[model samples]
Target: MSENFDLIAVSPHPDDAEIGCGGTLALLSEMGYRIAIVDLTNGEPTPFNDDPQVRLNEASKAAKILGIERVTLDLPNRKLLDSIEARMILAKELRRMRPKIVIGMQGMTPRASPDHYQSQLIFDAAVFYSRLSKWEDIFDGLEPWRIENVFYYYTARELLTQSQPLQFTVDISTHFETKKSALLAYKSQFRAHPSYNPPIIDWIEGMGRYFGSLTGCKYAEIFYGSNIMTMNLFKHILD
Candidate 1:
């Protein structure tokens, strides 16, 4: 929380944001937008990753690659629960950051990780609770703030067979390489066991290209929103 940010991306693990929306973040950072990531967990104690500090270092490198600030909460990995305590902690961070746009996990994963859905629930609750004037006593001395927009990014382990339509697609052809670099920063997760893991980098790049083709771009990232966004017809729709 150094200064107010234009956007904040909430992630379940250290590399989740980079895997899902790194290109969008890199593009925004190049446009001089202040972007930050709030990681729900340190993403450690896995078969390959033992030290949490190593993961933090990797996350820091990824954040630097994307030119964004990163913060990690002390939540348990693989066991994140959607509780009031969790919501309040996230709400305090949201109040401190005061981002206009909030991006979080889609939470519609076919994977068995409950942390994904819990992260989504926490983001939903924190957004609403951060605007509560009555919670002044709980969230330090920060003022109440309401987010302008809420969006969801994809980070499922497997390719989705069916899903809801994307609200929008961001053309990230120019920034796709940057996104790859950020993803590569997590060596412990993706590159540690090349033989055991599928070609994750290739899959990520292919996914971007596939989404890009849908929007007539070379590379892109898809996003979903529950609420309709009002836009200027002449400025955006036509142009």
Candidate 2:
């Protein structure tokens, strides 16, 4: 409906995208993709932060560090829901941006904010609502734009599920430091207190290396999708 983006990563909150798939975003940006991150909420009223604008400023800095565009929606932060209103609001953004691919924050983080799960539902519904036929009135008269690919990125603390969908890995060995820098940009979330920040940063490193080992790489991020991916293995295997 408006500017076209090659890829869009939908985050439930400001730092969600960075923690989930920042390295992939950096890699994609370096490979010349027009990428944008759409944050469903500005992530406010946290234990560490009192001002909501600080979260927005941090998101902007993270986006800059990753070398990508960022957008913050007016949706509720902690109390986010997958209601019809939320669906329409996110669908409007999808219609406006018209991205070919969308990577959504996936899985339920019960130990963390429940907004993560609701955000996943909202992301799923909005992607469907965005491509509906003759629903121009619902989407502010914007034309229906079908997203070609929909994938999900794992969150920080997600519930383990036996029904995990088809999964793949994106090698981020080269851009992993960029990802760390982007995530660290959110100082409010990763403050340099004696007990808070160090372990989290170490976890990030361990997680990336673990996932990368799955694909025989030094560092990588995992992605999940409902659709079957077609690929020729011979093309990637260099003797």
The candidate that wins on lDDT is 2
Score candidate 2 by lDDT: 0.84
Task: Give the CA lDDT, 0 to 100, for residue 163 in model 1.
Answer: 67
Query: Which number leads on TM-score?
Result: 2
Give the C-alpha miss distance for residue 200 in model 1, angstroms.
Answer: 1.5
Residue 149, candidate 1: C-alpha displacement in angstroms: 0.5
Q: Mind giving the per-residue lDDT tens digits that candidate 2 earns over 1-239? A: 39888789999889888888899889888877778999998888777778888878888999999989999998998899999999999899999998878999888897888999999999999999999999997777899999868888875588877577588888888999999998888888887353644455787898899999987999888888876653321112211
- The deviation in Å at residue 170 for candidate 2 is 0.4
TM-score for each of the candidates: 0.91, 0.92
- lDDT of residue 64 for candidate 1: 99
Model 1, span 97-179: residue lDDT tens: 88878899866565546788789999999999989997787887788998857888875463466566646778889999999
lDDT of 1: 0.83
